[model samples]
Target: MYSSRNMCLKWLLLLLIAVAGGAVAAASSAVRRDGGVTYDRRSLIIAGRRKLLFSGSIHYPRSTPDMWTSLIAKAKEGGLNTIDTYVFWNVHEPQPGQYDFSGRADIVRFIKEIQAQGLYTILRIGPFIQAEWTYGGLPFWLREVPGIVFRTDNEPYKFYMQNFTTKIVDLMKSEKLFASQGGPIVLSQIENEYQNVEKAFNEAGARYVLWAAKMAVGLNTGVPWVMCKQDDAPDPVINACNGRSCAETFVGPNSPNKPAIWTENWTHLYDLYGNATRIYKPEYIAYQVALFIAKLNGSFINYYMYHGGTNFGRTTSAFTLTSYYDPAPLDEYGLINEPLWGHLRELHAAVQNCSDTLLYGQQTNYSLGPLQRAYVYSGDERKCAAFLVNADRNNTDIKFQNRTYRLPAESISILPDCNIVSFNTAKVAAKCTERIRVPTMKFDSPMLWQEWREVIPVFDSTTLRSNLLLEQMNTTKDTSDYLWYTAEYEVPADAKAEIKIGSRGHVLRAYINGRLVGSAHGYFRNFSFTLDTTVLFHRGVNTISLLSIMVGMPDSGAYLESRAAGLVNVNVLGNQGSKNLTDKYPWGYQVGLVGERVQIYSMNGSSKVPWSKYTISPNQLTWYKAIFDAPGGSDPVAINLNSMRKGQVWINGQGIGRYWISFPKPDGMPSQTWLHIPRSFLKPRGNMLVLFEEEMGNPLGISIGTVYLKKLCNRYNSYPFLGFSSTRRS
Candidate 1:
């Protein structure tokens, strides 16, 4: 009797164990399926899960392949599960039909690095990405193509775009970087934020949008495609919102079967040209995020710049009226943007705690006030979550469900248990460092007494021996800033010494025997200026040298198509700047920099060029070479041209970047001083410097120094000033 009773108990225990095992398998299956989408809602479950997604945006060409690993690891530590990037077209193909993907242009290696970190990838392939990028990501070669207009259905434009897009897609496919192939990229974008400027394009714009969607769909990556800022995207494409408050931003009418997503939550504004503004505060950012999540039915949201990296070399875009890079959370030096980073991190953690309810459960809103609203999502009695958000900049306190919560000027509130407030936007206590890098006021050399020499005109009007007019962007193709428009003006036998020179606009420099007599640029209503060539013109075969510099081009507008660059409607005005001469005469036109065609810089690395002895009267056109060991280990090196004038700099033959020590802004500040030295733009052994100083200045005083964060400290309860935060005690 005892044996029979024990046998029955054992069988009962076995049955219970099998049931538990089956339940565990079912839960695991649900977690895996939650990541992707399906045709029917009944086939999928949204609630009862937690996700660990890491993300960062590192442009492939922004930094070299050597720097990719370290960058990816840094993102991982910052709690990123994904790496996001926009494929820049200009950097990929500067010249048409010439495909080069080696060195920093290696997008394949960039993704492989992200995959190496065991992280997912978000590929934002906007051939028209306006990340403050030059030419809006269109290659310079594209503009030169006959009858080709950008972002349209023009066959030439579409053909080129399709070619490059498919090339990149194929390259990634070969590397198996798409999720369907068991790789990193799970999301891809088409035509970034087009709806914002849709009216400008009209039907062609709508057709282009459809074309972009169809093209992307044709790639067949097995993952759903996304169209950011498109309120009317076609079916099967998930239209995502992009902006500071995308939570309330709606989906496109054409595609309604996908979940809502916030492609970009502007953590802070980008840097502007003038005085750099500080990023938004952490509490403010947190408040914004809370508001976005609470007000909208968003299933997923991504920061516009979770990590803003450096724009090394000429990678920075500056075509705007003034250079406004937009002071982002991360500065140009790639330093941590503290308080901002911390406050957001805390908010992310809080949101994560309730991810199950936020991602899966139904959202219900409660009106707290005129501008205040709250959202409650309950997965279970113990797993309920709540949020109170005030979008206004003014402070607001609301009473809800027998409890009162205070909302800061522009912030949010999070309640994990639904009944108790665990986090408040006005109450973030994270610490941050406040610091700035002061420009080197002085260098080792003197400010003045260094160099002076004039550029000899090798290709003057008589020297060229040809009469033609070259259009600025078209003929020269932006290879050089200066285009020589010269003609031999016959002075009347009974002539006054001065000749009145005039042009359609200003920005003309008069030169006789390569001497800079005078220079003029358009300032106000009048673009035409004067050049007193009283002694400039002579009898028989005289050369008139005009150096026209383009300040900035027409970036956008209907009139952009009509804007002209270089000397237009040029003529020499005589009789005390009255009578014009050589108005209709045939003029000789020569394109590009005098030094460029000569290969004066020798940019392709060979051997270190020798430095010439310091000249008492430095020649204006002569190139100067200086060698120095790369300013200690790993610290960024910069040359203080503050003492010198305008010139182009080359390190070990590679163009480090352009520098204008004296070209201060309208605000009376230098054009730019510090030249950031990236690890990729440097050489290990001996480093060389070559400068073509147009306006000769001090060369001996030019010194190379390192750029490092001056101070690293912590200030408590004030997060989100920059993009990072510190856990250090205040």
Candidate 2:
């Protein structure tokens, strides 16, 4: 009995020692909390030990709050220690004076979810983020404000920016959501990629940046403030890089000292021109991350899209109405791109293992070629990590240091322990299924016609009102796609009166008796052109309807600023289209569609729409309605609008997307064509299809179909995920 008691006491003492040691280590590992800032480091020198930190980005409005916890949980599983997000100004303050923080737009809830996952947060309050968002996330009302030049040192612009930024800062303070106040947000970003186009503004551009830095620093968020793409970032404002190869985009000219940060490591390029079908190789992306870490020093990395979510509702902006393509890994439907998710997870785990060496150590570079290079982050001579890169567009095998490495086209390689090959840039073996829309039925159903009439007198109203005559980009806003350019005309009988109309190059359907005479659109040309005079009268009250439709908005540099996206000049022509008609007439105008006032898609909807049954009719330019039960399951659904002309489609009052069937032949110019129906835009019951058809076509020919990714058979390598092996197939 004495011997047993003695043994038990010894065991108890050992357990107590272990517990105390762990407590000390944990206390030391407590993140370096200096003021409102936390260094994203690998270890805390409590007594002297190493730890790991993980992070991710969760744009609150990208997904609903209901999805926040699950999304953060997924990030945790993927070994993320932080959650980063850009606070969208448009989504938060949708209207002037009305601030919304509820629902999916709840920034606080989103950070709390990240905190719950034991993760830190990076709040990028760009207030001016250009994430392919509409108007670059600015309130539409700003456009209507007089003399407001955005991103410049104009009074109106600064006044609005200050008010909005202050509101956001105050809100965060109230919620104690900043790391400085024990909130999860450790870092806050001010102006977005301003330097990308700053050269256009000259001195004002430099001045605007200085003012932005001062403004952000003055907020006193108790955390570090960063500005991505700004090389001339002022003191105390850390400048970060953003791009596909951001690991190389240097900190702007006059700035140094602050830690280098890869603010947006674009895992996959976002979709453009409405294709949304391009799938990037997962192995390639993993290699990119590994290579970024190896090449980029100072140890801060953030994936632009850790999980690319759906662009629900009207949030999906387009260069044209039909440009809905995003080549992101997670796709718009929230589907986990298998090999991408898996391969990246492995890469993250590998990075975590070398966190200590990468975070605190200095990296030295060794050259191979412009594309191929090496980065060694060393603590001790033998204890080091190496990264080999081959960003070559073509495949090449390099024998380096007595080890053979096969480099695929556009890839990077990571060597954690110098001798062992852990990850390669080219070896992703997953076969990307190029999804095609297959016709389920052998023959398309019979057709029904519809006759529609244009409200011709729409352009002849006395009160010609535009949201603002000449509003600036991201300012005057997107309240009305149509701008009323009212001018009257006097038709001379012998003068051969003709109306030559020119617009910003969009759909312009003209009318005489309010009867549709002819239409001109910019889709076929950079700008639209038309001439008509058939409905001439003896100089009486003549009305003309010029429906100007906004195909999409402009997104680019300063020259695009003055390029004019709507109607530029209109003239009255006579004498066989070569002569001029009455030079002057007071024209009236209206903006947007006639149906916008009825809240056609709103739930508290006033109009009772009958969508369930189908009817046959000969209608030109008419609104067609159809209702069908949603096909069960989570697979994506697409409406084959091959038979339909140009129109806007709504599923359950939610815009499934726009459809334009006119495929421009190989004219050597891009055109608006094709349509995609995302499953996220579907509804189980009362699934409505509202189409504002521009031409006469059979709506009955339209049918909803499923788009499935077909398995691809590779004939090259015998790899399963990438290439297929056929040697053993009998």
* TM-score result, candidate 1: 0.80
Worst 10 residues of 2 by lDDT: 721-730
- What's the alpha carbon RMSD for model 1? 12.7
CA lDDT of each candidate? 0.59, 0.59
All candidates: CA RMSD (Å): 12.7, 12.8
Tell me the tens digit of each residue's lDDT in model 1 across 1-730: 2356654654454344334443332332344443332221111122223332334566666555766787677666555667788888877888876777788888888888888888778788887787766556767677767887677666788898888888778878888877667777877787787776666765566667667777776766655567888876655556777776454445422333355566777765654333334465566556656665666545456766765554543444442212122233443445555655556666667777777776556678878887677788867555678887776567778888888777665456788768777778767565555544443323344332222232444343234433444556565565665567666555544344554455444256677546676665554234456555555455555656676654333333221233455554445555534434344465666675545565555645222333345655655555665555555566545566765665566666566555555445566776566555566666765555667676666676676666565434555543325532421100
Candidate 2, 464-527: lDDT as tens digits: 4443223212322465444434444445453435566655555666665555666766542254
Residue 195 lDDT (model 2): 82
